[model samples]
Target: MEGKLRLAKKNLNISLKQKPASFQTSSPELTEMLGMKLAKWIKKHRVGCVVFLGPFGSGKTTMIRGVIKGLTGLNNITSPSFTIVNQYAKGKMNVYHFDFYRIKNATELESFGFSEYIDSGLLLIEWPEVAMEKIPPKSLKVTMEFLGLKRRKITIGFI
Candidate 1:
């Protein structure tokens, strides 16, 4: 088990070096697919941070919600737009989902100790443009763009 785990880690490191990013088909169905893929990937990594960026009305939040629903081990998923941050847990791992669309400044995020949360859990941040300066170095960036009323294009990258 230990050797397998080590080998997996080594392969992941090499893969990250060779191709640190991935893009997938986007739509309500594709969004769900991306979410499931992301969830599975996160399970292997155990923990990481991610940020989602998109213009208003883009389906960034929707894609995440779909992922949470499709992936059972992850805790119940809900939008944190009004609450600022929502936390879900699966076993020992935690996923902190945040929406800063209504937030204007870093100060608003400071009260939440946004830095600490970004470091601690698998952070999924929406409307990250408003708080780009606050994102941790390990955070992966996911950018979504509206392709149609019900479609989106999402690109995932490690930073």
Candidate 2:
């Protein structure tokens, strides 16, 4: 895990260097496929930080469910909304999912000690609006916007 984390820590990981990809997803399955595709880009020897910005019922959890499954073959991934943080791992590879919907600002988020783990594990943050600047420069930012009742325009890039 440390070796993998070290790779992204240096900003040399291939995922960080990816071209921006946009998806028009109207179904949960498609959204999850996008995440699964993302999982393949995160090489075995590299860690990652992904920030998700979207409204409620925007398929964030579904996408994360796929990412977790693709990354570690985990089948169950509940949103960490109330729990704040949820941890999952397969062997030495660890993934931490964090929800900041309840957080009000960067100062409040700092108390969670999230930044401490940014340098190591695969950290995925939902509702990270308040801590954008606090995240790593190489971090991937996924922004989801409503296009219709069941459609969303998701943009992925390094921010």
Candidate 3:
């Protein structure tokens, strides 16, 4: 099992050291599969937080949908853009998805108990560049950028 986990991490382009892992995906399905791969790791490792940085219309939400689907086996997922945050639950775990684009400052997070939320369950945040400093240093940071019309380069590693 350990060996398989290691292999999965490697194939998924995830690095634990200063060297970040990066890969390119041409389709949303591939991106979602990568999200699912990340889901397995986070669940097994009990990783509490993951932050996604990318431009608007990027695959952040799509990838998150994959994570939610993988974590809960619930295929229906939506962006928490206007809603701010969305919660999904499985047998014994919960996933909190937060979108911070509309917020003016990271301070707003404090009002909603964002810090406490991190400890409650797995958190997947989008448009977190503004809140980067507030995010825990131990959390995972994922950056996705466009490389072409339909291709995106994704890098994953610790914050």
Candidate 4:
């Protein structure tokens, strides 16, 4: 485990070592490590809004699910593509998953109290380009890219 973590850390681009925490990952197990780190952040900071940007088939959804699985008691995590949004409860907090792929306009999210969700629940938005103008400026961004079959490079850009 230590060796894998060291390799993962070595492969990452340290943009802000001065900041509390940051990481970049290039393999599936390494990606899971990054998710664990973010899980710790969520536990410590209570983050509500997060945006994930990446090309198709880059495993963004997979990483998010891994994070949710690692989260204690967050058992109902699922892709929200069909319903547009899926809410999962973890103890007293709520995690809202949003998929904007089918959304023709940003206004479509407004009717569902998008601002209110951003204000209150932990939101994981996929295909966030459509509502990029509306998302909070401080939201954490995770971008993923295809490295090869069953391989991915995930970079976390925190704001």
Best by lDDT: 3
Candidate 1 pairs with clashing backbones: none
**Cα lDDT of model 3 by residue, 1-159, tens digit:** 433343345565454655877777777877787788889878876788999999986799988988899999998799999998999999987999999888777678677667777688888999886677778767998899999877788888888
Candidates, ranked, lDDT: 3, 2, 4, 1
Question: If ranked by TM-score, best first, what sequence of candidates would result?
Answer: 3, 2, 4, 1
- Compared with the true structure, the alpha-carbon lDDT of candidate 4 equals 0.68
List the lowest-lDDT window of 10 residues for candidate 1: 6-15
Q: Model 2: residues >4 Å from true position, as ranges? A: 1-19, 44-47
Instruction: List candidate 4 stretches off by more than 4 Å.
Output: 1-30
lDDT of 4 by residue, 82-152 (tens): 88888777687667788888887767767666677767777889998878888876677887877677566
Candidate 4: the clashing residue pairs are none
Each candidate: what lDDT?
A: 0.66, 0.78, 0.82, 0.68
Model 1 — TM-score against the truth?
Answer: 0.76
Give the alpha carbon lDDT tens digit for every residue of 57-96 in model 2. Answer: 8878888887888899998899898999999989977999
Q: What is the TM-score of each candidate against the true structure?
A: 0.76, 0.83, 0.87, 0.78
lDDT of 2 at 77: 91
